[model samples]
Target: MINRRDALRASGLATFGALALGAVDAGLTPAEATASGQLRGWTPLPDPAAGGVTSPPFPKNLTAEERRNLKTFDELDFTVFSSADWARLDESHAKHVRVHWPDGHYTDGIQKHIDDLAALFVWAPDTNIQVHPLRVAKGNLTAVTGVMRGTFSAPMPDGKGGYIEPTGRQYAINMATVGLWNRRGTMDEEFLFWDNQTFYSQIGL
Candidate 1:
């Protein structure tokens, strides 16, 4: 006379009891026992780099140009945002590259973009970003989505000849960028988009 919900609840309680018993017998806490692989029928998550069975594979039939564009995009994200290697901008961006921000402001050239990023890093030295989970490249265009995480532990510019004191708060915001590549395998135009309100709320601004 057991309903499906009751049966599921009973099964869950039984499983928890077994786990608790196993933990006590092994002289460990329940959490420690679970983490130590005591849970029956539990499978560890597969390595993302190994492209597990559940992961959708990238297109294997990409053209040479498309592959090059994708590689360049990855390098750009690593060097420019993750690694903060401003000097290497030439490797992935044209000298005349233009970068557009969500606020409708745009950097005219690579040097200008470097200056803008430098000021940002001054505000948040621990800034680190990674592009992943969603990357697409076709012909001379590439798009990537990821999160930018950092701690606001330094004074920030107020754009009015003054500075705002550090808040020491951390923020992570989802962002996306689309790039128009040139024939030289470097980005000529990049458009970045993110929710400004979410970012400001997270940092208590």
Candidate 2:
């Protein structure tokens, strides 16, 4: 004795239940499955420890300035970008810092830079960046290259104050940043470069 709307609702719920069970079997939580979609045909890689492979230690023999810059960069990446700890912004940037992106847009103050970075999480809450193998520091400049990876699992803000719907697509794009640290041991300027076209294509935008 179900009406058409009731029958449709029941069918949708049954389908969702099946998908959730499948996601659980694939080692994903229900929430992850809801955000990341059904990861069909995906398999987790074997553990590296099983093959006697271990990660190497951090680089050594850096000058005092180089080491300090590296530490600051690591703090900025792990604390601010990856962990979303916005309060640590001052730890890496000066009060009047300027951040320039590849798109010719720039943020003037430390707070504005922090706000720009924070907005990314509104679109992709799980965004993370990892620097690998290419850290270099000399004098007042520090440069690092890494991959920024995230899933577009939330609405994105459009310029007109409306939001575009979530795409549920994940992306990993290579990016590089160069920072100029002042005598105060905080970056006074930073330049960031990344490919916007590749990002857009990967996110299905």
Candidate 3:
């Protein structure tokens, strides 16, 4: 069984990957994007020193698919921070969630999922992900795009026990995820894609 921590972590990676693709379309190399200190029309990456919420509040009116998509982001942005939030996953995800990441890695069950999330935070302590308004929702599928911005301050682990040294540079990249919901109205599987090379190249990893 996937633990609550794994489920939250897995969701964060998938969500970040899916939303990062938007950076590629913007014609900004991850380095170029962070160098400018903005993401063009998208919201500016939050200043870690100046603390404030960057993600918009969930809209009052939403389509079924949109609500589901928003739930995923909420889990990453809000619920994952607290142990109590694990219950939120039960309401929004299956016990046996499956995840696919951009690096062609796969994980099932919750414990593996939590491990991914832990690895990510370890590399970028102040990383932040937010949803953009542009979303597509149809039936059991929903796609939300956004940006992930953070400074690579510590050695990042490769999951194989190796680690990538931080370049001490910040990165802003586009991400997008297509979520598949089970019959229970929860996300069962997610397909995530982002420019790993772009991210690595930006951070000089």
Give the best candidate by lDDT.
Answer: 2
Model 3 off-target regions past 4 Å? 1-69, 78-91, 158-163
Predicted structure with the largest TM-score when compared to the true one: 2
Predicted candidate 2 versus true structure: per-residue lDDT over 169-203, tens digit per residue:
99887666767788889988787767789889999
Better of 2 and 3 by lDDT: 2
- TM-scores for every predicted model: 0.69, 0.70, 0.61
The whole-model lDDT of each prediction reads: 0.66, 0.69, 0.61
Worst 10 residues of 2 by lDDT: 48-57
> By TM-score, is 2 or 3 better?
2
How do the candidates rank by lDDT, highest first?
2, 1, 3
Q: Compute the lDDT of residue 194 as modeled in candidate 2.
A: 75
lDDT of 1: 0.66
lDDT per residue for candidate 3 within 1-205, as digits (tens), equals 8443344346765444433344344332232445657654454556322334345444434566667766765565444523334435556557688887888787896556666665666878777664353354444655655566788999987768898778899887776666677667777876666789988888886
Q: Give residue 84's lDDT in candidate 1 (0 to 100).
A: 82
